[model samples]
Target: MTKTERQKMQAGEWYCCLDSELSALRHQARVAVHQHNTAPPDPAEILSPPLAALFAGHGENCLIEAPFHCAYGLNISLGSSVYLNAGCTILDTAPVTIGDGTMLGPNVQIYCAQHHKDRALRAQGLEIAYPVTLGSDVWIGGGAIILPGVTIGDGAIVGAGAVVTRSVAAGQTVAGNPARPRNGWSGQ
Candidate 1:
């Protein structure tokens, strides 16, 4: 598992201090714009164009607002018809995958890596990567934070300002500080 993922991580981090990575990322987005079909295409403000291109393989309809931050964007896979509102932050030290038609409200955060609590490991300045996946049709409200390795299944809705530390299954609606299942969505 580590072998397959390590290369990508290395490839992505390689550009953290290199200009070539930025240039390459931008070039890819331009090519994608010409090669694929994108709606309301800006091609101008694709934030972190290099990083976006590296991670955005075939993921379309992504609305990434300015001032976004990430260690690596290559690990993210966003499906079509999705919107990421303002001030969205993705720690994406690992991989963050958002499914089709998913909606991310303002100030939403999806994280994929966390440092060890123990000082010994934390002192090393190393991180452990965890993958985050949002299933199709999921809706995450504003100011919410999805922690590492958490999965939100299809059609699940997370309330505003919730802190998700566990996984939520399909059709569940959850809220509160730690985000417990509030019961199934009240809709037909």
Candidate 2:
């Protein structure tokens, strides 16, 4: 008869972030992330057992450098050969899909949660989530911020320090804040 906060969140509907269930989930993610960030590196594993278990799915050779953080790790799915450099943060309130061969440079941030515009609603932690998808072979440069509901197509290049507010088409090269397609630029 009634949908849970988690269900609403996954459905891209407005939901309260301060819900007890969501709080508990975030706590669990924090613990795993702390361990992942602080633990000594082991050549044997790309991700620690506890940390790897948090993801919905992760493929072969997926590497996420230390100091990576996610609001809800279970909402992330990484394809084969996906590499995320250090200082990456993903606010995965909704599902985040990284396709095969995608590489994210240091300090890249992906945000899926959009808080309510109303001050009262924001104070209450009300937000809606939208999935962010990166198609195969995409390259996101350092310090780039991919906002909610953006889908980056295959082979696209996102230049450093770009704030991508819109979706990028396949094979496009975009740079600068509010990321627009770069004209006459060959992939050098």
Candidate 3:
């Protein structure tokens, strides 16, 4: 039997994003996000119920500022004490796991979905998704962009405006586009 588009996407295989089931999921997520974003400045009223219900997993003490965005909220998980500042966007076509105590600065973007390099295939809406994982205590600076399949190790710091295309070692400090280790400081 052929797998559904969502199944293919979850398996990290190429799939059609225009599938009806996926569209419905996106719509549901948008509704939940709208409510969360527009809710009054009360954590108990917003995060505890509405925002928490949208995610696959949400740990205690997690705080996400308003204006957060995600394609499918169900594919994202947050650990305890995680804080996401304003303008954070997660394109969670695949699972996105953020470990405990992780902090994301304003305008941070994490994308799990990628289109085919072939323009023809991309034009047809063929896309692949890979999971993104951030280890405990990691800090992502403002405007950082983490691409598909990237794993940021524990306690690592991603400098502002970095474009992380590959995995970062634990405790490493990475900066610049296509992010590289800063000042020869290894994770040590």
TM-score per model over all chains: 0.72, 0.97, 0.95
lDDT of 1 at 113: 67
lDDT (Cα, tens digit) per residue for candidate 2, span 113-153: 99999999999989999999999999999999999999999
Best by lDDT: 2
lDDT of 1: 0.70
Which should have the higher TM-score, number 2 or number 3? 2
* Candidates 1 and 2, the one with greater lDDT: 2
Better of 2 and 3 by lDDT: 2
Estimate every model's Cα lDDT from 0 to 1: 0.70, 0.93, 0.91
Please list the residue runs of candidate 1 whose C-alpha ends up more than 4 Å from where it truly belongs after superposition: 1-51, 184-188
Cα lDDT of model 1 by residue, 1-188, tens digit: 53333454444321122235544643554454333233344666443354455564536656665445555566678887777777777766666888888988889988876666777656654456678999999999889999988999999999988999999999899887899888655422
Model 1 Cα displacement at 135 (Å)?
0.6
Instruction: Look at candidate 3 and tell me the lDDT of residue 17.
Output: 92
**Residue pairs in collision within model 3:** none
